[model samples]
Target: MDTMTYDYTEPVLSPKGQKMRDILADYITVVSHRLPDDVTKKLVELSKIEVDPLQRLIYDTMMENQMLAGKLKRPSCQDTGALQFFIKCGAKFPLLSELNAILKDAVYRATKQAPLRHNAVQTFDEFNTGMNIGDGIPSVFMQIVDDSADIEMYVYMAGGGCTLPGEAKVLMPGEGYEGVVRFVMDRMTSYGINACPPLLVGVGVGTSAETAALNSKLALMRRVDSVSPNKNAAKLEHLLEDGINHIGLGPQGFGGKASVMGVNVINTARHPSAIGVGVSTGCWSHRRGKINFDSDLNYDLPLNEGVEL
Candidate 1:
């Protein structure tokens, strides 16, 4: 793949646009250090369920690590991962014209200010960009809406352990949805623990492999407490969660009662001839956050309510 061909445009920002970039830098810093509310709450719940003495100790250490990261203002993990942004914005957004530039600068500034580990290495050259900006770095996926002025953004760090190489396949018409379950089980049992277990599994079912792969990652942006709104999808979520947890991968894959915080499935109507299924996982640390901005750029960090910046 020629990463240079990725359509990431850079534009000069106005004074107001510069300010938005600064705010986004701050948002990245906060997200990098603080676990989002839903993820934190789920971690607490899982900690209580863990009965193994070693696993209980592991949870305690995990909480301590999170607390110290926030208190000291540092990344929760050394890897810090690759920056990925999922954005849904109105075409009328105040910053729509400058959104891409702002996001790119946000990553650059966050890399320096947050002191995030430089993880963007030139694929063929194997040379680190050091600034966290390079060809295709800080990937931004956008969905444009009309007749509104709000923007919703999801920020995720594709850590070394999490963001595992996802699996996707198109099942034949006769295979049926049961094949989807079987595929997920195969992947989860084989590699889910390797992603630093107590994972959040995101499964996507759609008409084709590409759509399934995209939806799988998007599902990771949802609140950990949320289940699929679709009845069958919700049931699959429960069954997958139950089945994976029964494997005893536990916190950090050290072995315990719970292997995953939750399993979420996002689906679209598939073609009559095929069912495409994909799976992705988030590690226990789960460094992801969601925020909403109004026309004026005044933002609401629903996942970080008490966070001022």
Candidate 2:
């Protein structure tokens, strides 16, 4: 193994960096109570747009859940789910060294302040680490996207009930993208009941199984109603959403209309002989938060942070 010792440089931060940490921690607390403003508005609109009376009732109840959760300062679901963060850090940010620590601290603080359930466990040892940190326990995925002076971070709470049925498949070149659709349809129909209904299904098409899996998770980081940036992908989004919703899994998979709130797809070029696909499904109770910060640590809150934590 090559070994070298170099003087480690510690990143210094403006006071804004410290303030940013508190803001982020507090953000987790607030969102844990109320659905993000954008999400609430979308849910309500979806409720109104839903043609089926059964689905409309589910939508109405979901809104009421949001209201009660916010008022009572309680988690909306008992599962609380596994926390994941998809972060894009800027290369020149003064507090790069501090970012990880900041996030870990924020998560810990949020757990206590929100009284978040203890979800982190020490594997093999079979122990709850309690602080929600273990080897990649919070499952943070970070990419240094550019030298620009801003960071975009998303906090996603993925529940086990929804992920229990996730899938990935490798198709032969002859199968093509049609294989992806087939796989999604199979999974949706086969195990749709395991996941909460009115899903926000995230699909990934990429070069490898791991890439596809990661992209599947990333696809869900997008807004529920937002279309993919790629035009072809956007078309696929509409097609998949319609196809799955047609199943009428309805709320809690109880059977009705509105099988999915949306379908979001993320794609990457693949090797000549392989087609990789994966899916990450989010229930209507999808709880994810987005916060953006400048190199100065000035946070641009997502439209969701409507209430004070």
Top lDDT hit: 1
Off by over 4 Å in 1: 1-11
What is the lDDT, from 0 to 100, of the residue 189 in candidate 1?
84
Top TM-score: which candidate number? 1
**Candidate 1 clashing pairs?**
none
Q: Residue-pair clashes per candidate, as listed?
A: 0, 1
Q: In model 2, which regions exceed 4 Å deviation?
A: 1-18, 49-54, 305-309
What is candidate 1's local distance difference test score? 0.88
**189 in model 1: Cα distance from truth in Å?**
1.1
The number of clashing residue pairs in model 1 is 0
Model 1, residue 291: distance off in Å is 1.5
- Per-residue CA lDDT of model 1 for 230-251, tens digit only, reads 9999999999999999888999
